[model samples]
Target: MSLIVQKFGGSSLANMQRVFNVARIVTQTYNQGHSVVVVVSAQGDTTDELLSKAYEINEEPSKREMDVLLSSGEQISMALLAMAIEKLGYHVVSLTGRQAGILTNSRYGSARIKSIETERLFKELDAKNIVIVAGFQGWNKYDDITTLGRGGSDTTAVALAASLHADVCEIYTDVDGVFTADPRIVGNPSKLRDISYDEMLELASLGANVLHNRSVEMAKKYGVKLVVRSSLNDSEGTVVKEVGSVEKMYVRGVARDNDIARIAVIGIEDKPGMAFKLFSLLARERISIDVILQSIGRDDTNDISFTVKKADLQKSLGVIRENLGMLNAKEVKYSENYSKVSVVGAGMVNNPGVASMMFEALYDADINIHMITTSEMKISVLVDVEKAERAVNAIHDKFKLGEINS
Candidate 1:
């Protein structure tokens, strides 16, 4: 029998009826004579509610304790899902991340999985038991409960699939499949039939939110297959594999990230090691940067602008400000009014006019581009957060991405 690893997001298990709905989806796959393993996220708003409760008690709760608290959301989902499967006359068992033998580093709220001991998973699967795993959590080296940050459930599922060598890992969400643009932002965006791992990775990192970027990275590294589909329907989902369709689609999808803040180091010395010293300080603090632009040196000084997630704004500002004199920088300036909009596709590597076309779209839409960055597979532009949605629709329409045969 083929082995399948399935993951359900919070929306799929939001209520009792939805939980049972997920259970039936699992059992139906089992009835087809395949070995099934399921991973699940917290129910609707459970994680948020828990975070609110924690903040109410302590504005700055201990990271270890927060991990412990957040991890419970997935555990509740696993148990309730297991109970539903049992009621459907299926042999089922629930296991937490630790119980399932997932080991991670001691990073508390953003731990990276070190390794997974698959002996327990194999034994349970061999016994014909449907294994339900609590996603987004694992035990660290210090024996402390740790979480894998937001959207970590997707990483958990892919990691499990790689460890078990499952035939396929299906990620069930609220949408039917990956769309050219977020449906809420762009009307009538087309759904991709399939996408390459690299394309999906760029989209995820650029903020498509259909899948996690780390999961896509792992899938690419281990050659694991992924399918993203809706849990509430039987639609054919989007397939993510090593190579996508052979069609010459220059732009496959448009994505917008509103969670970014721009930081500019103003009046920095235009010397050789200044930029290096400035960024190295932020790196030491584990802050990630994106879409960097360096202004031409004038008057022996230059301005460097870059973007970071909004969550890291304060930390990043603190790091830069504290080291301003050391790096020969004058001042640190930041703004939370900017957002990133990107278009991703493998074809962009060999295509010309992609950037100009994207710019043209923005120009037509009366939007201003602040910063730009490009790679072989993607192009990202920063614009006003308030105009981000219009920018996305403009870019998507410029490429005619919504057309079925485009």
Candidate 2:
């Protein structure tokens, strides 16, 4: 019998009926005599509601306390799911992240998992019990509850599957599988049958929300098998592994992220270490920058523009402004009206004209491109948020991504 690790997202367990739906999915696997371990996120909107409640009490709650508050969401899910499995006359045990031996660094709301002690997991499995562990939370060295950032449950599940050396890690969500483009934005985008870890990682980091990027990183590191499918259906889902089946396809998917804001630091002295001094300050503040563009030095000055998540825009500005004199920069300009759209594929490594094709599509759509960046597997462009949807559809059709499965 295979040791299967299954994870259900918040949408899959939104209510009583849905909870039972997930229960049956787990029990069916258990009935087949395979050892089962289940991981779950909070019920739908519970995390948001809890956050609202916390903010109502305090505008800026302590990160430590926020971790304590947010981790409760998954606890509710695990217990209810355990009770549902019990109602089905099956043996099940529910454990919180701490009880299940998930250890993480003390970063509070965005803690990084350190290690997972799998003795308890194996002990429970040895007793023939279906183990249900709370996702998105673990305890730090101080014994305080810590949460992984949003969508961290996917990371939790994959980490467990790696530590346990399970046969396969199945991530069940609302959608059938990973698609070439978000079906909501690009009509009838093709769902991919299989994707490489590198391509999936790019799509996830670029804001395709089907799977968390950290989970893909861990899966690749440990060589764990992964499948993403809809919990509500029995269709075969997308498989993520080292290599994709469609080797000749130059592009695999298109993704858009609307949470980014661009910052421009203008007129820095055209000298060595200027870029390093400017970015090192932001790095110390843990503000991640993306899609950076540096202009050629002119008149003894150069300008650098970069993007960061909207949430970090203010903090990033604060750090730069506080140290403006130290970095010898002239002025800081910022905007929140932009979005990033990207295309990812392993086949892009040996491909040419991919960028030109993308730019041509945007040009035809009359969408203005603000900045551009490229890697071996992906290309990203920043554009007005208002035209982001048109940009996505234009590129999707330009590449005929919808016909991927045909």
Candidate 3:
């Protein structure tokens, strides 16, 4: 039998009953003669609660200490899950990320997986035992614990599947599968049966929470097939692979990101390397930039505006304020009242008028677009946060994404 890697989200194992539910799922897979490796995140809201507690003690908690504290959530999930499997008479062992030989870069909060040592996993799997590994964390060269930030657990599961050469990497989430749009808001979004890696990458990066962007990157690189399914039931889920059946498709999914802020550096020198200098400063601080625009020089000066996550707004502003003179920028202006709406599909790269269709939809809805960015597979626009849902609905309806994906 082939090996399989399954990842359970926090909601899947929120409590003891859910832990037993997960164990039953894992045991069933193992009972069928296939070796099983399970990766799990912290139980429901455990990571958030940990952060709240940390903030209560120290307003600005150090990332290193936060890493130590946050890593405990997954550890708890792993242990309880292992015990649950044992109660069912299955031979099982739980391992933390470090104990499983997951090596990562030194970045405390958003560490990338450097490499995974598979000896420990192989040993346990060969002994006919199910292996449970904590997701989202790893050990750095300095032996300090580090995390992969948002969707880190998804990345962890994908990496493990690739390292162990598992047959499929199943990511169990709250939703049954990937949808044409968020069903909760769109009222009747359709689920996609399959999607390509490129399409999924664009959606994930643009803010589809179904899978993490880096995990898709790793899966594409390692040729690991991924399935997004619901943990609560046995339902057919969407498959993400190198290629899909729908090559003629466009607008596979519509995604929106509300945790966004736009910052404009006004009155910059408008010289060569000026933009580089300012962005380099943010990069040095590990702040991410998205949807950048530079206005034409007016009054012998230019304005550079860019978007970043709302959480990074303060740090980005601090960096800009600190390097204003070096950047030759006069002032920094920022607002957290924006959301990003994007349409993602591989066919967009080959098809024409995708952006025109999206703009037409927004025009009909009377939504004002602040900034626009288009890539080979996607078109993204910034709109008022309050109207983000309406924009997504308009765009989804315009493209008939539900019909095509349905």
Candidate 4:
């Protein structure tokens, strides 16, 4: 029997009926002569509700205690799912993250998996019992409970799949699979049958919520095959593997991220080691940066700008202000009202006209490109928040991605 790791997101198991649906699917996979391991997120808005209660009690909750309280959401779902499977006449065992041997670093909220010990899990599988593990929660080195950061469950599923050497890791979500573009944004975005892990990573970062970026990186590192599919339907979904020469899609998808902020450090003398000194200070403060651009300013000065998550704006700006001597910038300007619009396609790497077309599309719409970043399969541009929707629609239509897909 082959081993398969299946993960269901919160939306896929939002209610008792949905719980029963997951149980049926697990049972079917088990009966098909496969050892099934299922990882599940917290049921529908339960985690959020828990966080709300914690905030009500304490504006600033301890990360350790917060994790302890938040992890219960997935635990409840795991137990209920196990019981549901038992009602369907199958042997099943429910294990929390610690019980399943998910060992992670000591970070309370945003821990990363160091390793996985599946000995107990293998023993249960030997006895032909289906194992259901709570996702998003793991144990620190000291055996204290901790929750991985947002989108932790996806990382959990991919980690488990890597640990078990499963043939494929199936991600069950509300939608059928990864589409050429977000179906909601672009009507009838083509459903991709298969895509490379690189393309999928771009899509995830751009705005595809089907899988998390951290999970995709793990899957890519471990050479694990991942499938994104719908739990409510019998569709085959999309297969994500290493890119192959055989072509199936000219452009895979487009993603737009509205939660973006850009910071510009202007009028710095163009001297050696200037950029390093400024960035090192921000790195020390743990501010994540994306899409950095440096250009020569008028009169021998330089302009450096970068993007960070909107929530980090105050902290990041604070650090820069504190380290102004190190940055040596005449002024630090930031725009909180900015958005990132990205178009992802595998063929962009080979086509010289892709960049030209993208720029022309934005130019035609009179949308200013603040910062630009490109990858083998994706191009992201920053624009004014008010024009974000128009920018996406313009690029989508300019590439004629809609016409090409439908």
Question: How accurate locally, in lDDT, is each candidate?
Answer: 0.94, 0.94, 0.92, 0.88
How do the predictions measure up, each by TM-score?
Answer: 0.98, 0.98, 0.96, 0.95
lDDT digits (tens) for residues 373-396 of candidate 3: 988888899999999999999999
Worst 10 residues of 4 by lDDT: 244-253
lDDT string, candidate 4, 255-320, tens digits: 888878888989877889988888888898788889999988988889999999988888888988
Model 2 residue 144 distance off true place after TM-score fit, in angstroms: 1.8
Winner on lDDT (1 vs 4): 1
Error of 2 at 35 (Å): 0.6
Worst 10 residues of 2 by lDDT: 241-250
User: What are the RMSDs of all candidates, in order?
Assistant: 1.2, 1.1, 1.6, 1.8
Candidate 1: tens digits of C-alpha lDDT, residues 1-406: 9999999999999999999999999999999999999999999999999999999999999999999999999999999999999999999999999999999999889999999999999999999999999999999877889999977899999999999999999999999999999999999799999999999999999999899999999999999999999999999999999998736576899999999999999989888988899889889988999989999756899999999999899999998888888978878889999989999989887889999999999999999999999898999999999999999999999999889645
Clashes of each: 0, 0, 0, 1
